[model samples]
Target: MRWTALYARSRHLTVALAAVLLCAAVLPLLLGDSWSTVFATVTLGAAVAVAGVGLSGQDLDLDRTASFRWPPRRLTHLLVIGVVAGGVMLAAQGLADLPIDSSWILRDVAGLLGLTGLAATLFGGQFGWTLPMGWAMTAALVPKAVGQAYDVVAWPMATADSAQAWWVAGLLFVAGTAAYTMAGAHR
Candidate 1:
């Protein structure tokens, strides 16, 4: 599949996968839940950063020329970008021995997709990781943002008690996807 082709050539994807693997092996065993959160933030922070893999001026033109699945190349590629990052989240969770709450972590993944997509659209993939990573680090280390903004900010931080978090995360995912697709379409 064309998605496979894109993934094979993506340095961002490569690094993201490697990071998830390393964190899975080391973080849970070495530290407590605090470090696990740190890992979660960092890994999900990769949302947009991973999109950087095949994104460039040249890559845009290439995508325009190549037709993948039913969706436009841009849409499919971005979808794959999100999906791969989400998979990394799942792997990290399983390895870390976190509870099997799909909605909780999935909301995080969806929110990340949105953040990463938004970052990639606004800033370009060159600095895709900057905003999300900054947000993640702040959320993890600062404590203030994480507690208050978990639901407000969206992402995995949203507690399990609220169904609203799922809606917010889905909104983020759609918004981010639209932004990315529109940006590429216009350019």
Candidate 2:
């Protein structure tokens, strides 16, 4: 029983950490080639990280009969958090004299929602979710690492969307959630 409880706790922690690492890894790619895009990615990443922190921190609070007072309130809280994150980022950009504008906040919100949709699909266990999530993470991380390695091995080559990269990322995300679900059952 003790070991089982320990495993559960550890698994939850692992998921939260994975969430952080995944977002951090993807932030660079999601930034693409625009200052606004970079700011938006960073902002959304921060918001998601914050949400993960909140959810993970309250893992034990699952016992609460009312985890949320109401569904709309839950949405409200998320929006409030997003606003705070965007406002904070904007303030920092202003102080630093970065060319970032507040208009990017809307884009950031949309990107954050897209990421959340992907994450939710992974968590909700539809179609081989487990393997894909893990694979997606690995796929995302491997390219950046390879880029660094190639710079050392050969002349720096500009990265482009490769066929293998797309397949790996897509497959991993779709299958990883399934893998996660299977792993959850074993625990």
Query: Which candidate leads the pack in TM-score?
Result: 1
Q: Clashing residue pairs, candidate 1?
A: 48-116, 108-155, 108-156
**Candidate with best lDDT:** 1
Q: Write the per-residue lDDT of candidate 2 for residues 1-187, one digit (tens) a residue.
A: 6643543363354554444444433443344455443344443455444333332122323423443343343244334434555555555555444544455444333334333334433443122123223322333334445654432221111122333423333443344234322222110
- Estimate, for each residue in 62-87, the C-alpha lDDT of model 1 and write its tens digit: 65565544245556766676666666
Residue 144 local lDDT, model 1 = 37
TM-score quality measure for candidate 2: 0.40
